[model samples]
Target: MLSIVPRHYFLGFIPLAAGAELITVFGVVNKASGIYGLLSIFTGHPITAAQLVLNIISLILLPVFLYALHSVRRQQALPVVAFSYVYFLDMLANLAFTIYFSVTWFRVFDATATAEAGKGTASSLDTASERGLSITIIVLALLFKVYFCFVLFGYARMLVRKAGLRSDNGEGKYMKQLQFIMLAIAPSFWRRGGRRAGKGRMVNTLEEGIEMY
Candidate 1:
């Protein structure tokens, strides 16, 4: 089911594309002089904008990363399931951020002032609305970041374990390589699978599949 050379490099760009969507959403907030103003001071744009740019960079490097992952996967990498779970968490985090931003923006913009008018009653109302929305996004982002960090650390541990396994395995050259690759980024696949880690039984079941394979 796997190919030595990926059938399409575009698949590697999926994360980047998703990141771009986030940038677009953030742009809306930036134009309104919301959190983007504060973010621009440090990141040259809002955090969301920075993330979008980083995503583009990641997209450019995805092919190489995927190749490396393919190599690892073929070797039956370690912490396979756990690593995949982390990637899944990362994607979900991004999606959650997007949804939260979108909803908050809509809430802020509903029946606000027009884009024209430089300074007036309408402008003040718009600013107030934007500020409220910004606060909400900030809080949500922090919460998500904390949750995501936990997942990231867990995934990192799995990756470290997988790396150790690679040294021990000596068979199935191509398969082992593919296995390693899959484990390396297995979190992304797990996220795509839409499975939750909250359920202990389900998590265990998924981990078993990763271990057995």
Candidate 2:
């Protein structure tokens, strides 16, 4: 029987786990610095209340993202749905970060001209520091992103090559699409696997081919 969830979904968990770790670190930093208030400034008159909403949203998204990933690993069609959920959560977090930074910069500008600018100036400096930390976390997240794509590419390649082997054909649409996506990332993977060699020979499994290359 065919597995309902692809093996690649399990492979994806590694990167997802890493991304979660980065987000957790980000959340801790936000809590430590009380920059959450800046988020509230955008939403309403009382900044603390607004920050509370933002924190709630972040708290909600983190768990939802993890749950989605878990569902994908366990259920049929769940991977697709889970991927969508995780994607949306990731986008929301990014949007929140952007808003947070913009508010901080605006506060900095406001503070530059006022007698009471000292507090705003300090807050702005802290915001900048926070943004720097977020950037570092984002870089770490990107590392996971690369790994996720690599695993996906490996699985898709396996499917394509398997189809070609059965047909004794030069190439198939699935194989072509896989090659295209892989090429978009690492051209080396495409060049090595998609290159024309002896016809009708079964391509090794994705893992074996990857090892050989």
TM-scores of all candidate predictions against the true structure? 0.29, 0.32
- Number of the top candidate by TM-score? 2
In candidate 1, which residue ranges exceed 4 Å CA deviation? 1-130, 133-135, 142-150, 153-163, 167-175, 182-213
> Candidate 2, clashing residue pairs?
none
For model 1, residues 1-213, the per-residue Cα lDDT tens digits are 111212222134433223322322333233334333445557755466645553544444344334434433443234333333434454565567566766666665644544434435566666677768776886787665444333333333334444544322524887567546654453333222213432665778999999999
Candidate 2 structure quality by residue, lDDT tens digits, 37-65: 55555766565454566666655555554
- Candidate lDDT (C-alpha), each: 0.45, 0.46
Lowest lDDT sum, 10 consecutive residues, model 2, at 1-10
